[model samples]
Target: MGYTYPVRHQTGTLTTEQLHLLLKNPRLIARQVASLTNEKFLADYLLSGRYDAAGGGVYYETETGDLYTGTDPEAIEPAGDYPLIQLDEGVPSAARTVKFGQGSVITDEKISREGNQYVQKALMRVGNQMVRYVDTVAWGVIASRVSSTSAATSDGVGAWTTAGNVLGHLMTVREARAELATGLDLDTVVLPSAKWAKLVGMLVDDGALPREQGNIALSGTAPVSAFGMTWLTSPHITGTDPWLFDTAQLGGMADEKLLSEEFAAAGQTGVEASTTRISDNDSYLVRGRRVTVPIVTEPQAGVKLTGTGL
Candidate 1:
């Protein structure tokens, strides 16, 4: 699950728990088990409309309002490096429920009466990543010397009027969180300041940051001082990681390599059919007991920091 290097100079610095966390990456795999344990429990077992449904059954994002048309409102923008978002104030609590029998066999006449309470109550305790998902950000800046417009004149550095002039920027925490999901899709991103306390509050209010494992860090502009919480740096799964091996996180997903026609008998429906394919439903599965997988940690748990002058 990991590769470790022994630093001769640093001997037994980390505590027992910290050392374990540093060494192991917790892995989760969800199989296609039609039971209470499978991730389907999250999507299927819950009362319909309870857990957050995968948007479009493909990409995951809460900003259904930002749907694209000919223009594709969420078009990519160019930046010097990775663009950043200012943490917004707060977000409203939006609950998504999973009604038991949307497409399933459970009919209104059958368990609707008794199961209704069970599903709602179950949904309350176990929520989906989408429920806690955050994806919203807006950009703004204050001009030095109080310039009405943003412009760069022919000078060494874009300078304002004098020493008294100053400029600052701010982004809503919600917006900052959303940018992490949509823009810089990361597994676990580190922040400059100590923002865990703030992030923990947001999670307490908004829900977990669309992830069971992995970390998003936020300290201060410097290493010593802290900011609040890097809760906003976390990112969502965009297009699937094509090369990742199939596992439990994928709902009882069968290994794609084994499913291919080459792996299968010679005769296949088509060329792609000849190749291996992952099931859409089981991809990114939840961890469970009845269905077990090798405990794997998030891919980018100790993600290296990118961008200059963080």
Candidate 2:
């Protein structure tokens, strides 16, 4: 009879490849939000990405395109008038930093997990925060600066409750657009969910065809096209006030340069997994500094449908 010796072997050192496999994949909530808002529209008017840490602020400039009135009725070239230029000052907001940690034990337990759910949530929070800021900037531009009063004033509280009022507001937005000498052909309006619902109901009561009511037959989120403008909904805005602005005439700015790293100290991660970690459940940091100023280059390009409960 032969006696067999029982042997067991274990490696204390973790390999780079093995460690990566055990790493949890993180979610990209920030990226998702960016896709929905920032990347989709807000970044278009970026005045500057380079925030001079020493300069303290950035300047945004806007000027109307050349004004050629009838190309000189005398059949001779008239003096070319320079565009009217305006400069806006913008200061970067404080950078938003969020930190999260994956403990050593949890790392192993979650190694088999599909992705970094925790990181995803964190990025989402950061993304949402940035978007909200953007929304704030945009809302301010429209509510405070853009002139809706010229064409229309507040309908009074609960004024948008009626179909006629809704249509009236839409007409004023068009009037606002027409006021621009070289107006951007604005074709979009943003409404709150409640306002959209009310608008749809009113349209239905008016006996308008589905297409006339924005043809919302197929999807609730489907954009409605009426009064020469496509109406969209945004949860960020108030139900009583809708934002009517020109997509062609909006401006936004963001520092696309994302500075991110994981702690090796956590390993690679990002608004994505750029901060994905490797160390014993180490922590990671994602930092983004954004200085955004939504400029109503053409104030006539936007209108705020007011008359709501303050």
Range of the 10 consecutive residues with the lowest summed lDDT in candidate 2 = 1-10
Alpha carbon deviation, residue 273, candidate 1 (Å): 37
lDDT of predicted model 2 = 0.44
User: TM per model?
Assistant: 0.16, 0.57
Q: lDDT of all predictions, in order shown?
A: 0.21, 0.44
Q: Candidate 2 lDDT, tens digit per residue, 95-151?
A: 222232222223444333433554334444554565555555556555665655422
Residue 19's lDDT within candidate 2 is 40
Measured by TM-score, the strongest candidate is 2
| Per-candidate clash tally | 58, 24
